[model samples]
Target: MIRIKRAYEEVKESDGFRILIDRLWPRGVSKEKLKIDLWLKEIAPSSELRKSFGHDPNRWEEFQSKYRDELKEKSELLIQIKKLEEKLGNISLIYSAKDEKHDNAVVLLELLNN
Candidate 1:
């Protein structure tokens, strides 16, 4: 199973393989605090796409579309995530966005599940 978690959330054993999917680290979060197993920055949306979306909920639909398009070129990274999930049983995708519902992690979860 794949799960999405906020970078600010407390780490738990049940989180399994924790992967940070953001291009940049979260503000005020330290490496020790986050405790991520992998930082898959390559799977993150491009800087241009990220800045254009700007975490604006109004742009969420468009963001998902554009991000999905970006993901097509990252099949190797996606396969890595799938392999981890197979080995780990549970894989947690971590992100640093304030808006949980509209963040890149949410879109990634959707893509991974489908």
Candidate 2:
């Protein structure tokens, strides 16, 4: 199974094989505190796209659409996520965004489950 989590959330044993999917590290979060197994920055949205969206709810739809298009070029990274899920049973895609419902991780969770 695939799950999405905020980088600042408390770590849990059930959050298996945690992967930090943000292109940039969460501000003020230390490596030890994050407890991530992998930092898959390449799986994150491009800097241009992220800047364009700016986490505005009004822009979420457009962001998701454009992000999905960008994801098409990241087939290998997507496959890598799948492999981790299969091997780990429960993998979490971690992000630093404050808007939980409108983040790239949300889009990725939907895509992976489908």
Candidate 3:
């Protein structure tokens, strides 16, 4: 199973294989504070795309399309994530976006589902 959680949230015991998928480290969050099992920056959207979207809801559709395209070329990272998913009971993708509905994690979750 795959899950999404805000980076600001406390790392709960229930969260298995917590992974940070953002290309950049979340502002104000210390590495030690984030109990992440993996930091899969390669699986994140490209810097160009991330800057372009800027978390704008209006760019959500475009962002998803572009991100999916990027993922197609990231077979190694995708396979790593898939292996982690199979090894762990559950996988939680942690991100720092304020608008949960308009973030890359949403697209990543969808990709993992398929």
Candidate 4:
């Protein structure tokens, strides 16, 4: 199973194979506190796409489309994530967006589901 979690949330044992998908390290969230298994920077949206979206709600739809395109070019990383999912049996993608429902993790969950 796959899940998404906020970096600010307390780490839980249920969050097996925790992976931080954000391109940048979450500000103020210490490594010791996170205890993630992987940081999949390559699986995140490109720096250019991230700046273009700017986490603007108005651009959420466009952001999803553009980010999906970015992800399509990253099948190698996606395969790795899939392998981890199978091996670990559970996975949680951690992100730092203030708007949880409108974040890259949400988009990634949607993409992975389909």
Candidate 5:
């Protein structure tokens, strides 16, 4: 199973394989505090896209679409992540956005699910 979670949240054992999918390291969060098993920056949206989206809920659909397109170009990373998930059993995709419901991780989780 794949799950999306905020990087600010407390770490739990149930969060089996923790992957950080943001292009940049989260602000106010240290590398050690995040406890991520994998920092898959390559699979994240480009800096331009992320900056333009700016976490605005109004632009969520557009962001998802653009991000989806970006994902299509990262097939190797996607396949690697999928294989790792299969081996890990339970996986948690962690992000640092304040808007947890409409972040890159949410969109990526949707793509992975389908």
Candidate 6:
């Protein structure tokens, strides 16, 4: 199974193969503190799309749609994520977004699970 978690949260033993799915590093979080298994920047949404949404709740639907399209085109990255998922008991996708409801990791988790 896949899980979405905030970058600031402490890594638990149950969070197997923790991966950071953000294009940019989360603010104020040092690499050492994150306890990440991988940083999949290539799997993140393009900067253009990220800036366009700007975390607007009104754009959430469109953001998710567009982001899925991006993911569709990134089959290699998806395959990599899938490979990790197959190897690990649990896959934790970490993101830096302040709003848990609107982050890219949520969309990624949905897409990955589907």
Name the runs in model 5 displaced over 4 angstroms.
none
lDDT of 5 by residue, 2-75 (tens): 99989999999999999999888889999888898999999989999999999999999999999999889998
Best by lDDT: 2
Candidate 6 runs further than 4 Å off? none
Cα lDDT, model 3, residue 105: 94
* Candidate 4 C-alpha lDDT tens digits along 1-114: 999999999999999999999999999989999998899988888899899999999999999999989888988887888888888899999999999878899989987877
Runs off by more than 4 Å, candidate 4: none
C-alpha RMSD in Å of predicted model 1 compared with the true structure: 0.6
Q: Write the per-residue lDDT of candidate 6 for residues 74-99, one digit (tens) a residue.
A: 98988888888888769899999989
Clashes of each: 0, 0, 0, 0, 0, 0
Alpha-carbon RMSD to native, per candidate:
0.6, 0.6, 0.9, 0.8, 0.9, 0.9
Pitting candidate 2 against candidate 5, the one with the higher TM-score is 2
For model 3, how does the per-residue alpha-carbon lDDT over 15-74 read when each residue is reduced to its tens digit?
A: 888999998889998888998788988888989999999999999999999999999999
Relative to the true structure, candidate 4 reaches a TM of: 0.96
- All candidates' TM-scores? 0.97, 0.98, 0.95, 0.96, 0.95, 0.95
- Look at candidate 3 and tell me the lDDT of residue 66: 96
The local distance difference test score of model 3 is 0.90
In candidate 6, how many Å is residue 57 off? 0.4
lDDT for each residue of candidate 1 in 16-89, tens digit (9 for 90 to 100): 99999999999999999999899999999999999999999999999999999999999889889998888879
For model 6, what is the error of residue 40's alpha carbon versus the real structure, in angstroms, after optimal superposition? 0.4
